[model samples]
Every structure is written in structure tokens, then in C-alpha cells.
Target chain A: MARNRVGVIGGGQLARMMIPPAVELGIDLRVLEEAEGMSADLAATGVGDYRDLDTVLAFAETVDVVTFDHEHVPPAILRELVGRGIPVHPGPDALLYAQDKLQMRAKLSELGLPVPDWAAVESADELGVFLADHGGRAVVKTARGGYDGKGVRVVTEASGADDWFLALAEDGHGGALLVEELVDFRRELAQLVARRPSGEVAAWPVVETVQRDGVCAEVIAPAPGAAGRVAQASADIARRVAEGLGVTGVLAVELFETTDDRVLINELAMRPHNSGHWSIEGAVTGQFEQHLRAVLDLPLGSTAPREDWSVMVNILGGPAEGTLQDRYPAALAAHPEAKFHGYGKAPRPGRKVGHVTVGGDDLDDVVYRARAAAAFFEG
Target chain B: MARNRVGVIGGGQLARMMIPPAVELGIDLRVLEEAEGMSADLAATGVGDYRDLDTVLAFAETVDVVTFDHEHVPPAILRELVGRGIPVHPGPDALLYAQDKLQMRAKLSELGLPVPDWAAVESADELGVFLADHGGRAVVKTARGGYDGKGVRVVTEASGADDWFLALAEDGHGGALLVEELVDFRRELAQLVARRPSGEVAAWPVVETVQRDGVCAEVIAPAPGAAGRVAQASADIARRVAEGLGVTGVLAVELFETTDDRVLINELAMRPHNSGHWSIEGAVTGQFEQHLRAVLDLPLGSTAPREDWSVMVNILGGPAEGTLQDRYPAALAAHPEAKFHGYGKAPRPGRKVGHVTVGGDDLDDVVYRARAAAAFFEG
Candidate 1:
């Protein structure tokens, strides 16, 4: 029999978490990491630049299907893999929207999907016009290379983006910045969807996500008070986005729930995202496993929640001095029901080194347990 | 901050299943496999003789604690590891009972545990006397190196053991055979328990185990009709057995439910056993993760069931042709709620290759789904 091999580019927590499900399903998962001893060290078969065509081609030759741990892999590299007949999930055409925010905003607008009023601006003078039209405050972001609060800023004046304009001009290739009206969002939510190359798509329940300083801090599955209209709207919109963009594998659509109860698209991720982390322990089929099955074109598993509620909290920065292992005893003993996951990265301020998930019938207890378990790691 | 390394000394399906949990908990698990291309090929770091002291010593030096994928490792090698100050959970003192059935029966008797009537006979003449005393019928078993009904026999007359007696006598060292009066049991049960070196112990709800040709065929958690007294009896027995034997890791106590309403000890295993496989999807913390914690002396996690019912069906022999992966598409599509686990073993008649687990509020539906999913691979 032939081997069921799935290759992943870039090594991070998403790649690391994929190992367990791959092992369970008897899939041989290989990772082309950025460097040696990255988060997905166990499955990392080689270390090289994901952006290098030759390096990525060599790695792609060894596996049946090519996927990503992150969306930073260049379009040329992914296109090359597809050209050589190597299957790539979330193929380049769909990934373009995720790679460049301006493209995503434009595509969502074209699809008539609800989103914050946005525009693609090439200069500070254009941004000044948008900011002036939107009550003098707007969110400005780079078209590419942005995540976890980087490459983004809130500009109250046109001069606020002058420095970014200068940096964009310094580079050889010209790039446009994405500008948007400062949304009056009551809270943040995320909708996770997995689509197969065969055109089958599955959507998990909408989850409420909390951000601290533009970084994801916590997630609550099946967002409280989001049962009737809001949940249905997000699932419908995300599924359509997946189909309209011809995406394969998992797609994460970040959303904004306005104070007036409207749900709007916020951002997009073409691989396993932080908002679905709770599924590993809370759902019948986890995102990592579904991602593998989707890329491999096998039938997807159930996405039904195993409990009434599940709360996931990221272990940011880890311990101030010791390793994450040092705190296992204390944290585990205190919250025996909490599921702990560590990324095996060194302690750094605001770096996501691990996460904890707790599921139960009581939402408050689950949230508290997840928080208490995670607190032990951040000294 | 020290690396939490748990070394396993065998590389069968048991060791293979441990990989997922180790990965989830961030424990660096290394396996010393007996041969190449075993079920745990991914984690097998050293391919050598587990019976050879030097090979085991070299492997032992790299990890913080030592455990087993099977109970076949010699006691001397385990004690040597302890002498060298390396931790060996279910250390030599406890593993002896599991390795030798006669020793286990004697110890359980000494502890006032409920067990079938049994005696050790060194020759066929002694066997005759025992058979004459026990209703002219008895079950004879070779105490050492026996598993999966390989060294067990049922006899209506003493001469059924004549061949075994000759084989035992041909060897340089004479060995005794254990003889027992076959209990008229109605069903089989198993109790799974995990204990840390610090004396903390936790047991899952007793489960009903079904056997076919002496191989585990299926398991149902919280065994039906065993909620009150029977459940308490089994948990009490298994915990006492773990504490009595000075066991550090997981212990599986296979029990028999007599027609007259009594639970009797049937067998004992010192590591993760097939009966508890349902815990992977049914319980809050699976047995593999708990075993790593128990062996490492870290606090044990919760054993609470995540659902009301869970049924696990073993896929023996896998497909008649092709690999287990070949059948995944059809099986997964038919039973999307079922969880499939493959051990990476080739298809062979009566060999355990994989399993399927289904958990829900209804027992009959869970059982049907588990069986239907497993059926997809048997052909």
C-alpha cells in the first residue's frame, strides 16, 4: 500500500499539534521547519527556507500533499508545487486573500460579505481622506507580513502612517496599505471552517475570542448568547468565503460583533488558527485532524462539541526564569481537569508558548479552570 | 526545568498509542523497539535487545524514568536500572507478579483478594490430583511468557497437559504450571488504575470487556448493570492490587463476573491495557497521558468520563488486502462521529491492527457506530 504522507511548511505550534492526530490516523507527517529545534521538532524532517523554491521543491517531492503551518510561504513556492502536480491545500489562489489584507478586504466586499468599511490606500494623503471620513480615527495595516499585532497601527492623523509609507517606499517593490474605519465592536468572534479539495465543507460553532493588545488571549467555544442569528450568520458567511475562494483545508475567519449586534468579517487565516485550539479537547474531531483529512481528501470527521462549553487560554511568555516543565506539577495538581499543551519554545514576552483548555457543563467553571491552569506558566 | 523524558522499553501498539499523549503533554518520549518497522517506528530511538543489559543500560541513561510497552522485560534489567538510580515505574518488585501468573495468584491470595481456586503443579501427576479435586475440569497455563491464549489450555482430563509437561521437562530448568478450576462466569470486566510514585492513585469507572478467541474484541465504559455494588467492588480491588504490588504506572485488572453475582480477579497487567483504550476519547484525560504522568511522579489528571457512554471495537487483522488507510475513506464517511486509531501494522489474521471508539449519550448507538466503523476494515 502507498504511504499517506502530508508535508507541512514552517514549524510552529500548529505544526506541532498536527503530530498527535497524524499519528492517530496513521499518516506520515513531515515538516520543513525554518530552523532546527523549532516547535514541531519531532516531525521536522528538514530545516530550510520555506520561501526558497529549490528547498521547498525538494521537501514537496517527498510527501503526497503539501500544506502550511503558517501562511507566510510565498505564492511562487506554492504555485511551483501545484505546477509539479503536488497537491497543495488552500492553494495559492485562495491563500492570496490571506497573505495580503487588502486583497481579503476587497474580495469580501466583492462577495457582498459584511465587513468594516475599508479601502486600499497607497499614500498617507489617501489614508488622510479615509480617516477624515471616518470620524478622524482609522485602523491602518500593511498589505503583507503581519500577525499577532505586528504590521498594524491605529492612526488618528495622516502623519501617523508617514513612517510606514517611508518604509514601503524604501523597499524595491511598491506596496499598498489597508485602511479601515475604527469599528464599534462589542466583542470579537471567530468562525472555523474546513473544506476539502472535493468541495465538501464543514463549519465548527462560532467562538468568542478575546484579544489583549492585539494578541489572542482566550477563546470560548459556541460563543455565549450567539445561538440564533449570530451563529447562523457567521457559519453562512465563513462557508461561503471558503467556497467562493476555493479553499481547501482549514480556514479561520476572524469576526467583529458590533455593538448593534451585526457580525462583520475582520481577518482571515488559511491554516489552523488559535481560535480553534479548544477543539483538541472539546470537540469530537479536532482542527488538526480535520486539516489532515481535508488535505488528504478523505472524509471529514464530526465537529460536534463534546461538552456544553470549553474555554482555552494561551500561556503567553511562559515562566519568567524556569522552563514550562517546571510549572507542570503545580498547575496540573491544581487543575486536574484542565488539558495543558506546551509549544517547547523559550520564554519571551508575549510569545505563545502553550495553551490550556477546560471543558464542562458550567461555562464559568471551565473558563476559570482554563485561566488558572494557564496562569501557572506566566510567572 | 529539566527535560521530562519517559523511556519505553518496547515498541508495539501500546508504545505507539503513547506517542499522541506524550506529544500533547510536551513529554519527550523515547522508545527502545525490538525491531525496525514496528508499530512505534516514529518514536523508536534505539533498535536493540531489551533483554540485553548493556543495550537497556545505554537506553536507560538518556531518560528520566523508564516504563514498558509490554511486561516481557526481565526483572534483573529493571532492578539494575533502579540500582543505577534511574526510575522504573511498575519497578521490578511489581512487574514480577505480572510476568508470572503463579506469583500473581499467590500474592493476590495473600492479600485476601477474590480469585478463582488455583494451584501450582510441577508435573502431570500433580495436575491429575488437582483435576480430580476440582470437578474433573481445570484450566492449565504456563506461568511465564504467555499471552493472548498462547500458553493456556482447557482440560477435562489431566493428559491434556502431557505435551506441555514434556516441553517443560525438556528444558534445563523445570517450570511449574498453574492450574485453576474454570469459573462459571457470566461476563468479563476490567478496572484501570494509575498510580504515582508518591502514592497517589486514580481509577476509571469499571468497564465491561468482550473477548473473542481470547483476544479483546470490544469494551464498554461503566459496564452496564454495574453501577452500584459491582462497580465499587472492582474499583476497590484494582486500587488495592496496585497499592499492594507497589505499582507506579498504570495497572489493568481483568475481572470475572460470576453467575452468582461476584467479581473475581482474572488477570493483571502492569501497563496500559486494551480494556482502557476507550479512555482516549471517552475520559477527560486518556490513559496514555496519565501513564506518563504516573511514571514521572507528576500529579495525575482527572479520570472523569467526558460522555455518558463510550464503546470501543477492535479491528483485528485489518483488511484482507491493502492497508488500514485504504478503508479509512468509506469507514469515516459512514461514521463521522467515530474515532479511528491505526497501529501501523500489516494485515494478518487475528492480529490487532487498530480500533474505533464512539462516545455519546446513548449506549446502543455508540456501540453500533463503533462496530460499523470497525467493520469497514475487517474485509
Candidate 2:
């Protein structure tokens, strides 16, 4: 009996989590990794460059399907792999919408989805027009590449757009720039869904995420009091986006929940994402496992939360004065309920090194424990 | 900061499950494997004979603590490692009781714990005496190094004991044998507990285990319909044994619940045992994490069941005809509530390759789904 082999393009925590399910399902996993110390380093056959066609082909030759760890893989390479009959999940067309914001906004607008009043603007004059239409304050973002808060800028006046316009022109960027109304949002939330090749889709409970300095700090699953109408709306929007885009893996829809309780689509990520990391221990089936099952065209598992409440606290790297384990005993002794996960990364200020998850009957207790445990490691 | 490294002396499923918590706690783990392609092969470093003192010493030099994945590690080797100041948890003295059944029974009897009436017999006359005193039947077992129904025989009459006596004499293995009156037991159960070096111990709910041909097939946490008195007695016995023997790790006590509802001590394993595997997903804190914390002298976590019930079904290797993934879709499609875990080992008939865990409000539903999912994989 031959196992279905899966080839992943990068070696990271996303790829690492996929391994547990791949082994469980008897799927032979092979990873094309850039370094020796990455998360999937133990399982992958190191392939130095993802851009090199020969290297990519060599890695794909041994597998039945090709997927990715991050969105940094070049689309041309993915298209080439697909052309050679290597089944690439979240194929180039669907990935393009996630890879390029200009394409995503245009497509969502066409789908009649609720998005911030936005337009692709290539020059200062175009940016001025967008700002004038939306309270003379707009968010200018690069259309092709950006993550977290990078590659985005808030411009309240027309004078501040000149430098970005010149940079885009000098870079010879072909993709149109985007401008959006700076909507006053209460908080950011994520609605995640998984779709298989057979069109079976599963949606996890919507989660509200808290960010500090543009990096995610905590996530509260089911988004507290979001059970009846609010959850239905968020899940419905995410399901539509997944099916409409023909996404064949985990899709994370980052949304803005305005004061009016309306969810506006913010961005799309086409693989196991950081926003869904809490699912590893909180949900019935984790996002990484769901992604593998969906992409492999297997039956999807339940996405229900095992507990009434769960909170995940990100452990950002802090000062390098002591060992992480020094704080483990204290944190575990105090909380005892927090599930800690470390990525084995060196500490560097502001870097995401690990995370802690806490679940219980009380949402406030879970949130407090998770946050305190995370703080212990960071401090 | 140096992390506490633990070197386990076997590479089976027990060691495999330990990897997750070890990695989570940033505990550097190294396994001394007996063969290639074992469950913990990915994390193992040295492959050598576990009985060899030199090999054990070489493996021990790299880690701060030495633990066992099985009970077969020679007592002499353990003593040698301890003599060199290597911290061998469940130290040589505590492990002796597990390695030798005669020693275990004698110790439990000395402690005034209820055990089957038995005697170490060296001749056919002694066995005949033991059977005559009972009901013309006796269970003969080897004194040392036995597992999974091996090294045991049932003699129904005097004639049945003659052949066994001849074989024992021919083998020149007069190293004491045991004959016991077979007690009428209703069912088998297991209670798991963890002990820190600081004398802190915590016990999980007693669980009833179902066995097939002496192999554990399923485990029901808190043991369905188990009397509150029996549960408390089982835990009390396990805790006292751990503290009395200075066992500093997770210890599993397999018990026999008789017609009178009295729990009898059957077997003892001073490491993470199969019966506690459900704790990985069903409990507030998993057994592996608890064991790590205990061995590291950290405070033990709560062992309360997250749900009212948890059932785990062992996935034994079936006939090697179709791919394991062939059943993945079916098993997953049928039971989305099942949490499947598979060890990365080549399948073989009767081998415990993995297990499935299910948690819910009802034990019957959880057990049925778990068993059905496991059977699906086997088929």
C-alpha cells in the first residue's frame, strides 16, 4: 500500500503541526526546507531554494500534493508545479487574491461583500480623491506584499502621500496601490474556514483578536457573546469567501468588527495561519489538521470548541536576562491550567517565540491565566 | 540557560507521546533506541543495547535525568548510572518492584495491600500443594521479565503441572516461580498518579480498561459506574505506593475490581502508561506534561477530566493489504468526534500502532465512536 505523500514548501510551525495529522492519516510527508533548525527540520529533506525550478521539481517529484507553510512562495513557481501535474492546494488563482490585495479588494467588491470604502490608487492625486471622499483621512497600503503592520501607512493629509507614490514608481511596481477609509473599529476578529476539493467546508467559531503594537497578543474564541446572530454572520461571510474563491485549504478571514457589529473583510490568508493557532488545543480538530485533510480531499473533522471559552496569549520575545524555564515553574504553579507551547526560538525583542493557551468555564479566568503565563515567559 | 535534558531508554509509543510535552516545556529529550523505525526515532540519538552499561552510560552523559520507556532496562545498569550520580527517576529501587513480579507481590503484601493469595514455588510438589489448597487449579508465572501474557501458564490438574515442571528443570531456570489462586474478578481498571521529588503527588481519576488477549484495547476515564469508594481507594493505594517507594514520575497501577467491589493491585508501571494516554486530550493537564513537571521537581498540574467522560481505543495493526489512509476518510467521516493519534511505524498485525480518544457528556457515545473509529483503521 502506497501512502499519499505531501510536499510542503517551507519549514515552520505551520509545517510542524501538519506532521502530526499527516502521520496519523498515514500520509508520507516530505518538506522542502531552507535551513536545518526549522520546526519541520527533523522530517523534511532540505531543499535550499524554493525559487529554483529544479529544486522545487525535485521535491514535488516524490509527493502526491504540494502545499505551503507561508505565503512567500513565488506564484510563478506554484503555477509551474501545477502545470507539471503536481496538485498544488490553494492553486495560483485562489492564492493570487490572497497574495495581492488589489486583486482581493476588487474580487470582494464584485462579490458584494462588505469591505471598507477602498480604491486602487497609483498616484498622490488618486490618493487625494479617495481621502476627500472618506473624511480626508485614508489608509494607504501596498497592493502586492505586506504582513502585520508593515508595508502600510496612514495618511491624514495629501502632502504625506508623495514619498510612497515616488517609491512605488521607482520600484516599477505594476500592481495598483490601494487606499481605504480609516474606519473607527472596535476590535479585530478572525473567522476561519476550511474547504476540501469535494467542496465540503467547515467553519470554526469566530474569534476576537487583541493586538499590541500591530502584533497579535491574545485571541478569544467564539468572540464572547457572539453566539446567535453575530457568529452566524461572521461564519456566513467566511464560508462565502472560501467557496467563492475556491479555496481548498484553511482560509483565515481577518475582519474588522465595527461599533455597529458589522464584520468587514480585512484580509485573507490561504493556509494554516497564526490567527487559528489556538485551534491546536482549543478546538476539536486543529486548523493544521483540518488544512491537511481539506487539501488532501479527505473528510473534514469537527471544528467545535471543546470548552465554553478559550484564550491564547502570544509570547513575544523579551529581554534576554534569564532562561524561559525559570519562569515555567512559577507560571505553571500559579495557573496550572495554561497549556504552554514554545517554538524553541532564540529570544529577540518583539519576536514571536511561543504561546500559551488556557481554557475553562470562566472566560475572564482563562484570559487572565493565558495572558499572565505569556507575560511570565516574555518578561 | 541550560535546559533539563531527559534520556529515555526505549523508543515505543510511550516515548513518542512524551515528545510533545517535552518540546512544549523546552526539555531537551534524547531516546536510546533499540532499533530503527521506532515511534520515537525522530527524537532518538543513540541506538544500542539498553542492557549494556557502557551504552547506557554514554546515553546518560548527555541528559540531566534518565527515565525508561519500558521496564526491561536492567537493574544493574540503572544502579550503575545512579552510582555515577545520574538521576534515574523511579530509581533502581522503585523500578525493581516493576521489573520482578515476585518482588512486587511481596512488597504489596508487606504493605498489607490486597493481592491474590500466592506463593513462590520451585518444585512440582509445591505447585501441587498450592493447587490442592485452592480449587484444583493454579496460575503459574515466571518471577522476572514478562509482559503481554507471556511467561504465564494455567494448570487445571496435577498432570498439567508435570510437563511444566519438566520444562523448567530442563531449562535449569529454578529462579523461583509463582502459583496463585485465580481470583474471580469482574473487570480490570487503572489508576495513574504523578509524584515530584519534593514528595508532592497528584492522582488522575481511576479508569476502567478493557483488554483483548491481554493487550489493552480501550480505557474509560473515571471507570464507568465505579463506586466512589473504589475510586478513592484505588487512588489512595497508588499514591501511598508512589510515596512509600519514592517513585518520582508518573506511576500507573493496574487493578482488578472483584465481585465485592474491592480493588486489588494487579501490576505497577513507574512511568507513563497506556491507560493514562487519554489524559493527553481529555484532562486539564496531560500525563506527559505532568510527568515532566514531576521529574523536574516542578509542581504537578491538575488531573481533572475536562469533560465528564473520555474513552480511548487502541489502534492495532491489521492485515497489510490497503493503505491506512484508505480508512482515514471513512473513519473521519463516520466519527468526527474521534481524536486519532498514529505512531509512525510500519503496520503489522497485533501491534499497537496508535489510538483514538473521544470526549463528551456521555461515556457510551464516546466509547462507541472511539471503538468504531479504531476498528475502521484496523479494517
lDDT of 1 by residue, A173-223 (tens): 778899998999999999999999999899999999999999999999989
| TM-score of candidate 2's A chain against the true A chain | 0.95
Query: What stretches of model 2 exceed 4 Å from their correct place?
Result: A22-27, B158-173
**What tens-digit string does per-residue lDDT give for candidate 2 at A1-379?**
4337788889876787676566555466778888777766655876578878888888888888888888777889888988998899988889989888989998999998889999988777777888889998888888877887787889988766677777777888544678888978988999999999889999999999988877888899979878887788889999999988888899999899898878899888999877888888889898988988887888899999988888998888853767667677777788777787776566788887778888887988888778887888865
Against the true structure, whose TM-score is highest? 1
True contacts kept of each: 0.78, 0.56
Evaluate chain B of model 2: give its TM-score: 0.95
Model 1 steric clash pairs: none
**What is the C-alpha lDDT profile of model 2 across B122-240, one tens digit per residue?**
77778878899999888888877667677777887655656656766788865667777787799999999999888889999999999988888899987988758989999999998
Identify the candidate with maximal DockQ.
1
Which one is best on lDDT? Answer: 1
Weakest lDDT window of 10 consecutive positions for candidate 1 chain B: B165-174
lDDT for model 1, please. 0.93
lDDT (C-alpha) at residue B325 in model 2: 67
Interface RMSD of each: 1.4, 2.6
